[model samples]
Target: MTIPQEAIEAGAQTLFEESQELDQDNSWDDELPEEWREAWRYAAQSALTAALPALERQIREQVAQEVEELKLNPKDSTTPHCVEEYNAGLTNAAKIARGKDQA
Candidate 1:
């Protein structure tokens, strides 16, 4: 199945929002000086912000690759059920046409 662009955007937005929330209320690095911890947080946030585009691109590429693989080798559950129904409809139409022609 193709991953919708909206889903990808939501995933990326979640990552960015979570990253923003990091170190907001918790002190995880007790060993480090307060200044060091603050600096580390700043650097981490900046790195994540700068890398957001690349991260989104990677997510898109990975999803596309998985979708292509599924298309090439779909499992029984993933196979289209509508194809059989469509074929059956065509057969019914042909039979009706044949009956009309004979009449």
Candidate 2:
């Protein structure tokens, strides 16, 4: 079967960029078509799939920093649960408005 070179290259790139090494004896060297292999290599180095988890972790850390800053604000009067309460209230209102409430 013919495979696009883009797929193999992408895969290889992703794997290498992630600092991952191939198992010379067991990796997808001779199994997949040449184009597919190239695309895969490309994916290894350039695809976002490999970096998604790392990026997500970074985002979470940033959000945590913002939360910490909010907690440190001396003039803030709201408790940490304040946002949770507001969200719950809004959810209840939406449910009632949609005629899902028993009462």
lDDT of each: 0.49, 0.52
Candidate 1 lDDT, 13-102, residue by residue in tens:
454456557735433323536674455555555556677777666665665454334332123445456644554555454444333231
Candidate 2 per-residue lDDT over residues 1-103, each given as its tens digit: 2334565565575564444353343354345567755566555555555565676567656654544444333235367477655545555554454335623
Model 2 lDDT, residue 64, Cα: 47
Backbone clashes, each candidate: 0, 37
What TM-score goes with each of the models?
0.40, 0.29
| lDDT for residue 95 in candidate 2, whole number 0-100 | 46
Candidate 1: worst-modelled 10 consecutive residues by lDDT = 67-76
Error (Å) of candidate 1 at residue 58 is 1.0
